[model samples]
Target: MKIIDVICSKGRTGFFFDDQRAIKQGAVSDGAAYIGKTATAGFSAVRQAGEAISVMLLLEDGQLAYGDCAAVQYSGAGGRDPLFLADDFIPVIEQYIKPQLIGTEVANFRALAHQIESIEVDGKRLHTAIRYGVTQAALDAVAKASKRLMCEVIADEYGTEVSDREIPIFTQSGDNRYENSDKMIMKGAQVLPHALINNVKTKLGENGEKLAEYVAWLRDRILKLRLSQDYTPVLHIDVYGTIGAAFGNDNYTAMADYLESLAELAKPFRLRIEGPMDVEDREKQMLALKELTRIIDERGIGVELVADEWCNTLEDIKYFADNKAGHMVQIKTPDLGGVNNIAEAVLYCKQKGIGAYQGGTCNETDRSAQVCVQIAMATQPDQILAKPGMGVDEGYMIVYNEMQRILAIRRAKANQ
Candidate 1:
């Protein structure tokens, strides 16, 4: 029942690495380069796989389990980094956290995780990536000790029921180009397209007209594809809120106006706009967005504003839900401390009646994506994001196939 070993390893996400935005921008000139903090003069290396830290635990009984550590390239505002979460991961685990729990009972790992999260390497809270990894390894140990699925362990931890039905998968468009979206639709997939207006604004100034044209094209293509399919996928766009920057005034009103236009562009398709404004401070963010919601509601704007950015932890998720700040909150998987905290956030959002989109960075690894699908299906969130990479087909296949296996296991147990 005691954790005997903690193993942390570094690998690539099999996707080109980018700092903040989903492969939308921040890509090197080639769109496949992996550049670190210091860009080399005239030559950026093409990393075969983006950097990722995967944590696995070996128990006394020889069972092993893993957790996904999706450390985003950019951790702060405007994609600030000379830093990556992978840098601190090994030191934090081997030097700081490993010694504390090598002999601790797996049953007490939840409290162990709480202690690990509170530890500061010199005046900094443990990175969310480290929290996710350590806690996931710990939870996996507990599940193995009890001979139960990690999702079942999570439900029992939170005193909630795991929904028995299959969870739906949502895929992201491979790139910002509207035509690329049709490929996934042709393959019978639901897609998430990042408008990446923030990137367009940074590189090509005040390009709202261009972005809107792309959206119009996407709407048309999706409608044409839907004529043949039974499932009408939602048109979910994550604008890093650069649309707000497109206006001369650069305020809430300008953002709201642009959003209304986008809403009109997405006629009759269920539309949700994630991150319309990218402010880092939570209180100010909620206050400002609450005002935007008021404006949208009063004017009857069709788009829904989703909160991301600073809404990282379980507390942040709960706060947004309690205040009714955004119509929905993007429950970024890495933000919640690990599986247990993630389950709590999802169930809390469900209880509070706020729409929770179980989402994460595209920089994640495949194992983490599979781990996420299990928890999402177990908890039954409103939607789940495709992960590990931005390639719509690859990410969708990994998540979708994992969900099918989970369904089969659940059905077999029911018959038994």
Candidate 2:
């Protein structure tokens, strides 16, 4: 099938765009919004409604293949593209991208996606969100044209197998950790409660006491609220570098000691700490995480380190994976630009013996989350994130349902 037309429309993401800089600077939360001046250059407020552009490709067969262009919750931070607003980007897409996409063959997702990835305006490439959504539409179009599931298309193109079983789903608990943790437990999330411990004073605590208490509480809560005794979810917390802030960024010894304590408290539940220390620079962040990971391994600490900050692009992921920066590297989908790159990153990480958490931002769309599920199914990442919103139920539901739908179709095809 050929792309007959390219359509773009403004849409709302499942969550709001948060200024990571402001939040890190101690922005106080007032109700659902944050009360502080915007620190990020493009942010209009400390917190603002997240926006996405739906890229729809009209195919010759009258099938409409679409994907949502979305940025992460903390857009413009950790060396990501600037704030992605629909109004600012729609014109750019129409002027530069739409024409190229128009009449293009959709037979090969990798080829078409590479063409989209290669587009440039005034020396810089298209925004990650645009590339992300456009490539998603491309993949969808290819799948539709072939009359196959998206996961199957990906598997064929990438020389991988579609997971016959379900991939583990990781759910995030944004601020409402306690309430969301309960929901996660009830839903039997393979990975429970990201427990957004971004702030030191309130979430992580000055001396890391607060997070320790929260982990202890989380462990107890799961044991108390779980419907089945067999339900044992991995506890993965994203502290956003507060641990490094509290214990001193370079103090790997102290950080390892604290992580060991958290592992002890998490008792029988595997623990992974993400973004343990964001030194704000890519090289330094890698080294810091590398040293930290080394320390934990040498000491035989049970807690696993997850790299997030400064690990944005495909190149960054490979670099981090090669250096053993962390046990797992969150392949933040949107940051990597195209959906094709998400699959490649996951495959690469697995090849390198690094755990790939096929994670995107909470600030994504349902469509984006669904596409991610297909990619995870084909690539078989260690864990896939329940995304687009912080509310545990909606994100989890979207991810879970998509996985089931794919699995059902795959099984039916096999039986046939």
Candidate 3:
């Protein structure tokens, strides 16, 4: 199939973008909006609606394959790309990217995606959102051209087998940790409640008592509400570095002691703590996490450490994985620039004996979430995030349904 033309359209993401620095610096929440000046460079407000650009490729056969370009909720804070406003970037994509893609013969995905990753204007690579979406469109176009599922295309190109079973889905509960978790339990999410513990005062507590209490509560609630006793979901919480904040950031021993306490509280359920500390610098963050992981291993702490902050790009993930920075690394899909990198990152983590959690942000679109499911199906990460929103049902539905569709189609093909 050949690309006839490229189309860009403004779109809204499933969630809003929040200034991570402002929130960490005590931005008070006023309803859904934050009541403080923006601390991030490109933000007009501490919290604002997330924007996306849908890059659609018009193929010769009248097929429209597209993907949404988006950024994380905490854009520009953790060494990520700047806030992705569609108004500013759509024109850039049209001017620089559209013409190059026009009339290009699409036979394979990896080369086309890498070409997108290599394009630059004014001496800088295209915004991560643009590269992310355009590559997704490329993958979809190749799949459509070859008459196969997106996951099949990925698996074929990457020398991996498509997952015969559904990847475990991890659902996030924004602030409605209690209520939304109930929803997750009812739905039987494999990984229950990302429990966004971002702040020290409100969520994590000054001494980490608040999060401990919440973990205990979650244990009890899951036991009570689960329809099937076999539905023992892993408790994965993204603390956003609150554990490090409560205790000193470099105080690995203290952090490990606290992690042990939480592990004890989460008895029968396995626990994973993500972003225990974000030193804000990649090298420092890796060392801190490595030391913490070493301590946890030496002490035989039942808790697992997941790396998130400062591990943005494919190279960053490899750097962290090479050092064993954390037991698991979150391949933040959008942060990796191209979807091709997401697959490579996952495979690399597995090669390095590191757990790969295929994750993106709540500030994404349904289309992105769907495409991510295809990637996870092909790559078979340890767990794939239920994304595009924090509300349990919508994100979970988008991810779960896509996985089922892929599995069903693959099953039929095998029978045939």
Candidate 4:
């Protein structure tokens, strides 16, 4: 089967109360949001006005799948929104990509992917982005054509068993200042009066100070819930960094301190840490990350590092890999120039024994998320990150959930 059509959808989606809580208190922003709900909380304040740019691909033999790319301000790049590229870039997908793959065999995903990657934009090239877009579309089409859930496809492809254990997702709440004392009291009284009183603390501001307290609360709550045999839900926290030169020495110190605190609080729950690094401040960010890594190692917790800015190219991955800079490498297909590049990076990481995670794009939709899931499963990265689907527009959660199901099936098949 060949690709029969490619569709690109552009628009914005507003956040929900819970989404806002995650973005503000959880520090959700950029690609980090999709990996899990806790990670998306980092952008609580900024994600409000953001838009989603989605690309969907349809193929012959009746298959439909898609993905999305979202843009947010880069802290180091003078707070400029890197996702701004989507505004001008989506048209390229419509003009160059849609018309070319009308009759290609649906299973020739690689060829369709390659052709999409071949398209160029300005003096720069967008073949990678186009390939990613097309691949996702094909996956969606195939899923639809097969009359199977995405999870089933993933199981067939990966040959692994799906774990019945509920995957953990982080959710954020509380005011920015951590001063929702009254709210906390009301909520806490129902649960634990003594513990609430003991944990009662003053409100901290939006920066790391407030995040520290909020994180502590989340960790404690998770542990308490687990003790009572309420072990299904996973715990998470969101930590946002200031953008541009604003992320200077002070910011790094605050981040370091907050992460250290989180390590201490999260030890009992074995919580995982995933967040977007400020790519604009390369030197300072690296220095801060190095410190954070030490903390994570000491705590024996897994850390997923996402580079919204720094890891935007193949060369960037080389730099990180060569230096052994990060533990788990986060990759965004569009940012890396396409599926081939992302695949190459994953291969490099796998060969190097470096864990890889798939980063999400806000501009993506179900189609884009589907494509990402396909590539993500194919790459077998350690983790898959995508946006939450709670707000006005459905986020990439449906795609992610679908992909998770697919991966589960693949895992089952593999074990068989």
C-alpha positional error of residue 231 in candidate 4 after TM-score superposition, expressed in Å: 3.6
For residues 225-281, write the lDDT of model 2, one tens digit per residue.
Answer: 888889899999999999999999998888999999999999989999999998999
Reference-based TM-score of each model:
0.87, 0.99, 0.99, 0.62
In the range 301-408, model 3's lDDT, one tens digit per residue, is 999999999999999999999999999999999999899999999999999999999999999999999999999999999999998898989999999999999999
- Model 4, 1-416: lDDT tens digits are 55657677765532322232233333433442322243222333333344555676565545456655443223113122233344666777777666776775544334445666666657655534444545555555555766655434444544433334322211223222233222223222111111110011222243445435655775565455443543423233323333112234335444545555655665554433433344435555555555555555666554333333455566666666655555656565556655556656766777777666555444344545555555555556655544333221133345446656765775676799
Checking candidate 2 for backbone clashes, the offending pairs are none
Please give the CA lDDT of all the candidate structures: 0.68, 0.94, 0.94, 0.46
| Root-mean-square deviation of every model | 3.8, 0.7, 0.7, 8.8
What is the C-alpha lDDT profile of model 1 across 183-295, one tens digit per residue?
66776665456544445544324757776777788778877876574656677776665655456323767777887887898876667877766564678777766777778
Clashes of each: 1, 0, 0, 74
TM-score for candidate 2, residues paired by index: 0.99
Runs with alpha carbons beyond 4 Å of true place in candidate 4: 4-90, 103-105, 127-131, 141-208, 227-238, 242-258, 271-284, 291-309, 332-334, 337-347, 361-363, 389-416
Q: Looking at model 2, report the run of 10 residues with the lowest lDDT sum.
A: 406-415
How big is the positional error of residue 220 in model 1, measured in Å on the Cα after superposition?
Answer: 1.5
